[model samples]
Each structure stands twice: as C-alpha cells, then as structure tokens.
Target: MQPEDLVRDHTIYACVTGSRAFGLATDDSDTDRRGVYVAPTALFWRFDKPPAHVDGPLPEQFSWELERFCELALRANPNILECLHSPLVEHADATGRELLALREAFLSRRAYESFTGYALGQRRKLDADLRTRGAPRWKHAMHLLRLLISARDLLRTGRLTVDVGAEREGLLAVKRGEVPWPR
Candidate 1:
C-alpha cells in the first residue's frame, strides 16, 4: 500500500505535538502533528514491507507504523514518549486509545539515559551554532532546557508530563532569547 494509504486508512492514533502540546505556544507556533499507523500484518508477507514511517500528506505532519512506534517507545525514545503524552490529541480510535493506555508501560528509569542522551546531542548542535552563527538558536536552547527539566522531574516523580505548567513563562523567555545562553 502507498504510504499515504497507510496513514489515511491505518492510522490509529494522532496528536498535536511540539510547542503547542507543551503549553509553550505563541501566536506563531507551528502545529506539529504526529501519529501511529498499523500496517496490516499480511503486508510483511509481501516482497516489500510497508515503509516504517511516512512524512505527511499534511504540512509538518509525520507518522510511524505501529510496530516501529512500539519499538522506539520500548527504548524510551524521548520524542515517541512525548508524542504519546501530548495533550492535544487530534484523533484516536479504539486501537489508539489502547496504545495511549500503555503509555506508562513504555516508560521506565531508562528515561534518564535516553532523555539525557538526546539532550546532550541537541546541546552539541547548539554549541556548533554558537561557534558558527555567533548565537545559538534560542528556541532549541529553550527546548533543550525544557527536556532536561522534564527528564529530571520524571526521574524524581515517576510521572511524565508534557506541559511546562508553572515554568511556561520562564521557558518562553528563553525562547524569546531573554535569557543568556550560558545561563
């Protein structure tokens, strides 16, 4: 089946992510959408299996096949875990709801390692930007700080939450470049 067919017919869960889902949106924030689609099991029997992911018939939209999504989730992938927790759910069928119900099962102490590793990688990119452009991307810096804080709090409390809640203003300040890069 075509990638779009998989998304259009098989997508079981879909939600808004990025700044909007994190309660960090400004008037111009893009609505980043993510979702999971389950390819028919029989598809694997074919000469070519389904694409593991699809980039979108909609702008800024993307999705993963169910098995791939689960594999990543099991590894405590930061982006997949956050996608499952996004509050701005746009679509969900029974299968999708079942997947959401398994959100906690997909998390563990491993988050500290995965989230921190991802943050460190992002930090390197920011560092490169600092050297090349003379200024780090303020938005990336803000999100990196936000991810670290979230990971720290999740490790401490055993609860994963996407919204910044009380830290919204300060994070937005960082996004606006009001905070110094070193700070």
Candidate 2:
C-alpha cells in the first residue's frame, strides 16, 4: 500500500507535537503532528517490507511504524518519549490505546543519557551558530534549554511530561529573543 494509505488506513495513534504541544505556542507557531501506524503483518512478509516511516500526506506531519516506534521508545529516544506524553492526542484506536498504556514501560533511567545527549548535540549546533553568525538561532536555543530542563525534571521525578507548564512564558520569551544568550 502507498504511504498515505498506510497513514489513512493503518495509523493507530497520532498527536500534535512541537511548540503547540509543549504549551509554548505563539500565534505563529506551526501545528506539528506525529503518529504511529501499524502496517499489516502480511506487508512484512514481502520482499519490499514496509516503510519504517512516512512523511506528510499533510505538511508538518510524520509517522513511524508500530514496531519502530516502540523500539525507539524502549531506547529512551527523547522525541518518541515526548510523542507518547503529548496531551493533544488526535487519534487512538485499540492498538493506540495499548501503546499509550505502555508509556511507562517505555521510560527508564536511560532517559538521563538519551535526553542529555540530544540536548548536548543541539547545544553544539547552537554554539557553532553563535561563533559563525554572531548569534545563535534563538528559537533553537530556547528549545534546547527546554529539553535540558525536561530531562532534568524527568530524572528527578521519574515522570515524562511534554508541556512546559509554568515555564511557558519564560520559554516563549526566550523564543522571542527577549532573553540574552550567555556572555
């Protein structure tokens, strides 16, 4: 089946993500959507197998096959873990509900490594931007800080939460470049 067909017919879970899902959206923020699709078992029996992921029958949309999604979640992938925690769920079937129910099974102390590693990578890019362009991408800097904060809190509380909650306004300010980068 085609990629859009897989998303349309086989998608089991989907949700809004990114700034909007983080409760940090501005009037101009894009609505980022993410999802999981369960391709038919029979599809994997073929030589072509199935696409591990598909991007966009809609703009700003992407999705992963069920097994791949679960595999990454188990590995404490920050993006996958955040996708599981997003409160703006757009769709969920029986399979999706089961996947959501397994959210905790997917989180572990390993997040300390995975989340920080991701944040550090982004930090390096921002640092490079600062050195080359004389200013880092403010929005990326804001999100990197948010990721680090989220990781720190998750490590402390043993809970994964995507929304920035009380930090929303401060983070938005940073996104707007109201907060200065370090000296």
List TM-scores for all candidates, in order: 0.96, 0.97
Best by TM-score: 2
Candidate 1 residue-wise lDDT, 1-183, digit = tens: 689899999999999999898999899889899999999989999899999999997999999999999999999999999999998899999999999999999989889999999888879889988899989988788878888988988988888899989999999998889987772
Candidate 1: C-alpha lDDT: 0.91
* Lowest lDDT block of 10, candidate 2: 174-183
Runs in model 2 deviating more than 4 A are: none
TM-score of 2: 0.97
Candidate 2 residue-wise lDDT, 43-145, digit = tens: 9999998999999889999999998998899899999999999999999999999999989888898898999898888889888998899888888888788
Q: Candidate 1: minimum summed lDDT over ten consecutive residues — where?
A: 174-183
